[model samples]
Target: MNQELLKLDQVSKTFRNDKGHAIQAVKEVSFRVMRGHSIGIVGESGCGKSTLARLITGLTPLDAGEILLEGNRICGLSGKAQRQVYRQIQMVFQDPYSAISPRMPVGTFLTEGLVHFGMISRKEAGKEAERLLQMVDLEPQLSQRLPHQLSGGQLQRVVIARAISIHPKLVILDEATSALDVSVQEQILELLVRLQKEYALTYLFIGHDLAVVRSITEEILVMKNGAIVEKLPAKTLVRDAREDYTKQLLSAVFSVREFQEP
Candidate 1:
């Protein structure tokens, strides 16, 4: 087993409605992700799975506790230090269409981070973007096109390429395959698995589908109502689930064909 890559200790978050009533989005969540292993966070919508991803990636502020990367505190670092820490993690959102700007050329989009990180010059961005596109199984010429020109699956691949262009150690995939056709979903998931092995990248895969989560992750965390209900190895998820929510989720997965196209 690899050493701990990330640790979240008693993390919590609260949200306020229009009337200013408090709603706990995440409640005392705690976990550790070992290096080079993919961990799945499965739950129904509004369960704070997405919020947890946001917290890990520093997109949103944590209301409590600490988020550590490689045992270093990551919650409050600022400026270059903050950016440097964040550069180690990348995010792939569910909707590629909305995730990227429709107006920017793919080449510019892919190399923006590389340029910002001083890893490459603007003059070399095009070539590097082409290389990244090919790495993600996309055609180099596609980099010249806009986001709207590509299919959902193609765009998702582009998003993956962008996320990895910076060579991140961790990738947070928030429902990354849920919006595509089932076949496309499988292809994307397989691409993720291959990328993971090739780069030794750690993944924080968030989704509502039990079967989908089980397909790629070795360990699973079940969440409901903003709290983690159980944690189990993926192989034993169906057989060893103890919580009613976990059983209900597993039953739902088994009730379906589990492979039908969406």
Candidate 2:
């Protein structure tokens, strides 16, 4: 059975120039995020990694192809229907430092998002905000602080909290943990895994860091020049990658001995 929570089929996007030129950004990309599974998309910047995330989450309209949400192709949905898609889909951006609202206190932004999505009432949102903070391993008191007042890792957690506040069906993480320290990255990754278990979140994790991606992903898609060059089970790819690009990505994460060592 197709138990996928998200699916992109023959999806492609392109930008145009004033002279009627088209610049292809994504080329015939296809993948799936199954219920409660994490799928990773890895590629360098400008490789359409972020674009694909936006397309899946309905942040932007696709130039071609279809995006399915729970077996329904909502890519063509407009107006009220599209808004409904937003409530089910959310994104955690690459730079938490800049992706979130610096002026608004963490609690304010988080609760506001929850209330806007009707996930929680104002009073309940406040309490839930604190609960979510704790889920991410942040102190409740930190909720009152501005983004600038918190560490990078803490800020990323706040971003995650805000993204998941609405209890989204699919969470698109665009290099979400790339900027944090190594140790803190582990914490955030663990928090995501825990949240996925509790919430049944279907994650589409985008990053160039294969090591970080492997830590959380069930499947991995290697992209190059705006297309998926290869797709494989994360564990199998780590052990035996078929594509050269996949090999190059894994080589950076695991040395020959590291993969073989006890």
lDDT of each: 0.92, 0.84
TM-score of 2: 0.91
Per-model TM-score, in order, reads 0.95, 0.91
lDDT by residue for model 2 over 121-174, one digit each (tens)? Answer: 787976887887887878988878898998888888888988887888889898
RMSD of 2: 2.4
Off by over 4 Å in 1: 254-262
C-alpha displacement of 112 in model 2, angstroms? 1.6
User: Model 1, range 37-113, lDDT digits (tens) per residue?
Assistant: 99999999899999999999888888999999999988866788879877999999999999888899988998999
Residue-pair clashes, model 2: 0
